[model samples]
Target: MIDVRAVNYTLQVAGRPLHILKNVSLQTKPSEVVAIVGPSGSGKTSLLMLLAGLERVTSGSLAVNGADLTALGEDDLARFRRHTMGIVFQSFHLIPSLSAIDNVGLALEIAAPELSQSQVREQASAALAAVGLAERLEHRPTALSGGEQQRVGLARAMVANPPLLLADEPTGNLDQKTGAMVIELMFNLARERGTAVVLITHDAALAARADRVLTMTQGELVEAAVTH
Candidate 1:
C-alpha cells in the first residue's frame, strides 16, 4: 500500500528553486493498480523516484507498506526499498554479463539474504517462467530482444515478491504488441501476488487498464474518471 500527501520536490537551478512536484497526493491499496499519465516534464517520473526512495521529497509525506519514506534516512530507505519495493525502469537495468536467471536471482539473493543460492535460483526461475520466459532463463540481455529483456527486468523486480511495484514507462522501448503483452504480464503477476502497482506512463490506453488513473499537469495530480 502507498500513501502520499502534499508531496513536493524542488531542485536548485540557476540559484532559484524549480519545483518538480506540487502538492501531489495519492494512495494505493494492496493489489491495487494505479496509473499515472502525464506529458513530458510533468514530474510523473519524479513522483515515482520519490516513492522508490531514489530521490528525496522536498516536503510532504510518503508512506509505502507502513514505512514512512519521507522520514527515513538514506540507509533505511535503501533497506526499505530492498525489502519492500520492486522497481521497473524504462531502460532495462540488467547487468550485461549476467544471464536472465542470474539477474533475477541476484535480486532475490539481495532482498532475502537468508535464502541459499539454490533457493534464489529456483525462485528466479519461477519468476521468469511467470513472465513467459521459461526457455530464455540462461540467455543474457544482449542475447534477448527488447521485449525479452524487459521481461527479464520484470522478473527481476518481482522475484523478491515485494509489497509494492513501481514501473516507469515499462514498455516504452518495445513495439505495440510486445508492450501490450508485457503490460498484461505485469498486471496478471501483480494481481496474482497481491502486489500494489504504481505505473508511470505516457500512453492513455495503457493507463486506462489500471484500477485508477491519475493525470499530472504542471506537477499537480488529480484522479480521472474512467469512461467505459
Candidate 2:
C-alpha cells in the first residue's frame, strides 16, 4: 500500500529552486494497479522516485506500507526500499557483469541476509522461471535480447515479493509485441502476489488496463479516473 499527500519536490538549478512536482496526492491498496500517464517533464518519474524513497519530497507526507518515508534516515530509507518495495526501470538497470540469476539473487541476499547461497539460487531460479526465462539464467545482460533483459529485470524486481512495485516506463524500450508480453507478465505476477503497483507509462491503452488511471500535467496531478 502507498499513501502520498500534497507532496512537493524541488531542485536547485543555478541557485534557484526548480519545482519538479506540486501538490501531488496518491493512494493505492494491495493488489491494485494504478497507472500514471503524463507527458515528458510532467514529473511522473519524479513521483515514482518519491514513492521509492529515492528522492525526498520538499514538503508534505509520503508513506509506503505504513513506513513514513519522509521521516526515515538515509540508511533506513535504503533498508525500507530493499524490504518493502520493488522497482522496474525503463532502461533495464541490470549489472552487466553478473549473470541473470545472480542479479535476481542479489536482491534477496540484500533483503534477507540470513538466506544461504543455495536458498538464494533456488528462489532466483524460481523467479526467472516465473518470467519464462529459466533458460537464460546463466546469461549476462549483453547476451540477452532487449525483451529478455527486461524479463530478467522484472525477475529481479519481483524476486523478493515486495508489497509495492514501482515501475517507470517498464515497456518503453521494447517492441510492441515484447512490451505487451512483459506488461502482461507484470500484471499477472502482481495480482498473484497481491502487490500494489504504481506504473508510469505514456501508452494510453496500457494505462487503460489498470484499475485506475491518473494524469499529470505541469507537475500537478490533474485527473484521476477509474478504468476498470
Candidate 3:
C-alpha cells in the first residue's frame, strides 16, 4: 500500500548540501513486512522519515496507501498521518505525564471525541491487552520494563487500526531474546491485521525474518538477495 519512486532528500548543513536519500524506490503491500537494514549514516531512518512525511523530499514521488505524500502540504500530511499511518520511534515517545491508557487513548481521542469515556477506556484496555499489557494499563512508562514500554507503544500504534505501520529501531534497546520476541509479536499482529509494515533496523537477523529486505548504503537503497 506504499510506493516510493526515485525519491531524493537533501538538506543544507552549514552551507553544504547533505544528501540523505538517493533515488530510493520501494513498495510495501498489505500483509507484508519490509525490513530496511543498514549501518549508521546509511539513511534507513531518513528514508522512513521521508515516507512518514516528517521530512521534505527534494526530488521524486512517494505514495503511502494511495496518498501522494510528497505532493501534500505540511498540514495535509499531518492529517494523513493521524488517520492512516502509525509510527513507532526508537525512543518510545510516550508522554511522561499521561498514564498508559491515556497515552493509547490519545490515539482514539484525536479521531473520535464522540466516543464515550467508558468506550475509550474499553478500547484502550483492549489494545493494551492485545500487546500483553492488560494489567499495566494504569501504569506509566517509568513503571514498566523496556519490553513492556515498547509493547505499549505498539498497542497505541495499532489501537486505531491504521493501514500502515512504520517502526524505527523498535527493538534497539532490548536484549536479544527480548528483541526477537517483540519483533515476532509486532510482525505477527500486524500481519493478522493485514497492515503493511516498513521497518528500519540494523540487525541482519531481524531483517532476514521480514517478508523482504532492503539495504541502504551512502543514502542509496539497494535490494537484498531474494529468498526462493
lDDT of 1 by residue, 121-210 (tens): 899999999999999999999999999999999999999999899999999999989999999999999999889999988888888899
List clashing residue pairs in candidate 1. none
Clashes of 1: 0
Residue runs of model 1 more than 4 Å from their true location after superposition: none
Residue pairs clashing in model 3 are none
CA shift at 50, candidate 2, in angstroms?
0.8
State residue 89's C-alpha deviation in candidate 2, in Å. 0.5
Report the alpha-carbon TM-score of model 1 versus the true structure: 0.98
Q: lDDT tens string, model 3, 1-228?
A: 888899989999999999889898887787788989888998988888888889878999899889998779989998899888888877899988888999999988775678888999899899899888989999999998999888888888888888989999999988888788888988988989999898898888888888898899999998899743
Shift of residue 161 alpha carbon in model 2, Å: 0.7
Q: For residues 123-210, what per-residue lDDT tens digits would candidate 2 score against the true structure? A: 9999999999999989999999999999999999999999989899999999988998999999999999999899998889888988
